[model samples]
Target: MSKEENAIIARKLSKRFPRKVFPRLEYFDVLRDVSFSIKKGERVALIGSNGSGKTTLLKTMATIYLPDSGDLLINGYDVYKHAEKIASHTTLISPALDFQKKLTLRQTLRFFHSIQAPYGELDIALDFLKRMHMEYLLDKRLESFSEGQKAITRIAIGMMKNPDIFFLDEITTGLDVNRKEDLVDFLKENISSEQTIVMVDHDPLIVERICDSYILLSRGVVVKQGRAKDIGKELAYKYEVMVIMKDRPEFDEIVMLFPDQADDVLIDGHVVYFRAEDEDELYSIIERLRLNRETITKYVVSLVDLSNIYHALKPETINEIRTVEDEKGLPERTPTFDELQEIIRLFGIMIDTKSGVKIPPRKLP
Candidate 1:
């Protein structure tokens, strides 16, 4: 409701990466004038397609990637001016941790923990690692660990920080069913309501377990954001009916049949997806397709999921972002490889984990 009540405030935030594509270096814009405010203590899911800038926005907000222009305020601190401060309070756990270094798991965890909490207790963190059944790998080199082991170790290290803001990027990647469920349950029970969690997870279980709200991104733009239940209302639908046809000969005919629901029809090869606002609508669509069973393969119907939301979003142009940057007199220059490395090193050096309590924090009452 107010500035003080917000945990993150991003205004006109934009970021781009220089890609060495064949003949010349091409500038690819990842985030374009993205603006949104996340309320304090909200467990919000950042939903978007593969290349929709979800990770970029999360890293930028956590002060990992410096924005070329625009302002980002997290927990009342200007990210640019307070990048070091923000890094201390925020912990970003990403797949980048999937390294095959020669160091053992124990050595890696100790190194990171000492960087943040030199006097903290490692036994507490180890106890939680035991819960994930990864304690046996403590002495094993990272090179010998499986993808799942590396992923679990990363989670253990990141959680050791006990940051005020936890940023999870594809957290469910490489995790097994039992361990994934255990980690989610432990976090849901331990993380206090005052501590914010911003995650990008595709697994329905994670979203259903923790996410109360979401921010949907489409091609580097803030397309939609609100409470989780509000997404269905935005699309004017409750359930999704995906009809798999042997051949899409009836695709155009189906579209013509429901001209009023033209926008709701999303065609992917032989699969035609339909939005049903209610049971009656869902029933009608299903029956109509059954008449053409000779041309149909099968059908699938379920509640609206994040992937469905991403597909339904219309992409926007980046010309407006370019025009705004030109008006602001922002110069377009790519940071050198060395400069980028130095920037990251500075981020590492500036992080102050001294304020954190012991790892594997006690459950808050």
Candidate 2:
């Protein structure tokens, strides 16, 4: 690929921090010989446990933290030598960003515009504020804004730059569900095929929604890197499908028909449950069930999501995504879009949960 097509390139990158105490200076290695590349227009996620050097790597790429050794390039430009060229096309938004506490959001935007010359006019910045739903807070000082508002303002400022490359680190941490959804929608609508985005986020839902590929880091080492679906398969997210038929004989008939495809099949009265390795296999089974529409009454299916992948990859740190509990302490449930798609793809097997006609066995005249 051409140099412009290569958004980021890191070769044997390493970084170390020096600690001084009394008469001695000691060095601690944060990243060691890390190497990776991200193509332009690819939304790549940087994932790892805390202190795994995810943030350190991002900062180094953005030139906030210089690597002690090795070459780092943005659009084929040497990070140290062509830093200004890199900055012209890139914007970094991190929770660690410090702003002038005394300045209002409007003043901050003006100052940033003066320094970076992001937009020739203030109108663009105002438009971004409106998009972020923060136009009302434009006059509010940074000290008066809540943590979430501050994050929104920072994101607004970053968006105003119209960057070709976005380097984001924990930018969604303080956002509520509504604001998060809005941000996700905004990204989906605005992030075009010409832009490159690198994000560091702990929320798997956000990562799965925004990133097309992932670079998994463990203890400053590259552990895995690939497309999202391949990574999902490598993690082995299985699906369990259960079909309830109008009669027990239909369940037995299905078991007899696809004994090879269905294993560990169990029959509880008129219900049958089977497992599939992945969605492809599940789709095949659902096709067969559709052919046997006369027998099936209702069905339910469950599969793994991004959260499951996170659990399998970082069981030590990731927490389970739990549905809220009712007053009686029973968990409530709602299907995510991914889960709903799986359900609808396999929705053929499900006749209806209540009061639906079952097509009787075909009669050859």
Candidate 3:
């Protein structure tokens, strides 16, 4: 590819932080020799566990943190050498940073437009706000807004910049179902063939819907990288398989194949588990089971669902989960979108319980 077509390039990039104590403890290397390239118009997801260095890599790319070694270039400009010029075309949006709580929504957006484009494209900013359903909150101070509202506002402001490259860090953390769907639709509509977006998220559904490619990070290293579909397929192959049963087969067969790894599968109202060396082996067993089809009720590959993936990658938060469950008991009536909201809330609480990282509760105006 031509040099200009390469929107982002990092070669052996690394970052380290020194100890804060007086004795000067060991230097903690958050990122170690990480490198990757993102082409123009490509949407890529960065997936990893917490403390895997996804945020550190993004900060370095955004020029918020300088790499201790190696080089990072964005649109032909070295991120370290041309931080100001790069900022003109690059925007970073994350819950942890990028918004002014004291400013009213409209005022903060106007200020961002003035600083980024200077000519004050107020019309464009207002248009975007209206599109995001934030016009009603335009006059309210950001501090008074809910977490979901703030997240949506940040997205709208980022869109106003019409950045050539956008970096998103856990941007979907607190959004409700409707708002989340709206933001996803907005991303689909606005992300053009000329812009590059790098997203860091634990949400596989988001990755499945929006990302063209994915890079799996573990301990600050890229363990796998490929098209999003391919990654999903590979994960399915590695983790799940179709099963056929005849006359309500004994549970031992299922348990023996999967052993400890079969928690994801359910069959005939009973949890089933199995494991094979690979996809081929798993399929082979299925084929044999299907030959006797007299007793098979249903068969489908049981892959790791998004929630399972999230929990697998992150440490479990037992206390937070119990607290959320305790507060929001199982609904006695038919479940609705409101119930889904409560579930997501409980999920976040569970994460907090284990990690001690609180995900601020979201509210509505």
Candidate 4:
């Protein structure tokens, strides 16, 4: 309700990049009227496919890039007008950040600490380095560190700041399973409700464990924003089970058992492929057929998750989910495969023929 109550607020935020194609300049939309607010102390995740503007949005919020047009407020202060003030309360940990490669781990911490107090505290940094099992490499130059080591180092530096709000952009890029687990443990122990965090991470397990909410972006727009658990349950809970039976095994009877849960049933050769909305539903089907376990030659269940949701969601449906209605409107819906082909033919971009794809007239010799 109040500025102090909100950690970040964006209104009609849009970003564009000019790309030159041949003789024409086309403005590529990176973020289009994307608007959302983060309550103070909320740990929210920003997720989407590659090139979905997650990084751009994070950079904009961190004051690294000014928006083409729109108002972006950080901790109740306008990002552009009060960048210096905001910097005091916010810290961003991203791979895009530049560092002196020649600087040793300890030196890097000292350099960043000079700019932001408490971030380079000797005691804190040393403690974190020890916990990361990296104290032994304190003298190692950044250029000599492995990618995972570099990630851990950057995270250590970020944790030292203990800012009011933290922005993370793909900080888990190079972490191994153990390192990732350690990072998650550290975040859980350190991040409290008194501090806010906006992280651009794709690992669903990590996200679900740390974040209370999420913002789903598509084609540079906020497609959905809600409780992380709820969204995950709604879109990521299903599982696909493929079973091979000694005989056909009554395909019609399996559907009867799961009247509502089982769907997309198909007998491809001898493999029966279908989907169950949840584990319980899948179990229900299994129980009904338990008496004939020997008849089931083989079976496989594939869990669906945020990745599945990303692939299944149409662009229009994504826009509708977030209900984005502002001056900067939704993108034009994508054309179907057939419709796209027709358009290409009309514009001579290329032509699909029986034998092969024909080159555009402009490229024809």
Predicted structure with the largest TM-score when compared to the true one: 4
Candidate 1 per-residue lDDT, tens place, 37-146, comes to 88888998987667878999989988888997788999889988999888878888998756547999889888888987743346656977888888888898999887
Q: Sort the candidates on lDDT, descending order.
A: 1, 2, 4, 3
lDDT by candidate, in order shown: 0.71, 0.70, 0.65, 0.70
RMSD of 4: 10.8
Q: Count the backbone clashes (under 3 Å) in each candidate.
A: 0, 0, 5, 0
TM-score of 3: 0.69
Taking the tens digit of each residue's C-alpha lDDT, what string does model 4 give over 161-270? 77888999888889999878888887887677799999887676677677778787866877556664454345423665667877754646655644553344545556
Better of 1 and 3 by TM-score: 1
Worst window of 10 by summed lDDT in candidate 2: 356-365
Better of 1 and 2 by TM-score: 1
> Counting only residues 3 or more apart in sequence or on different chains, how many pairs clash (N, Cα, C under 3 Å) in candidate 2?
0
- Which is the better candidate, 1 or 4, if ranked by TM-score? 4
lDDT of 2 by residue, 82-106 (tens): 8888788788999999688789998
Which of the two candidates, 1 or 2, achieves a greater lDDT against the reference?
1
Candidate 4 C-alpha error for residue 43, in Å: 1.2
* Model 3 alpha-carbon drift over 4 Å, by segment: 118-125, 232-365
- Candidate 2: segments with Cα more than 4 A from true spot: 118-124, 238-276, 279-306, 317-365
Candidate 3 residue-wise lDDT, 304-361, digit = tens: 3333233334333211222112233521222233443465366543222322222221
Q: List the residue pairs that clash in candidate 1.
A: none
TM-score, model 2 to reference? 0.69
Model 4 lDDT, residue 91, Cα: 77
- Model 2: how far is 107 from its true place, Å? 1.1
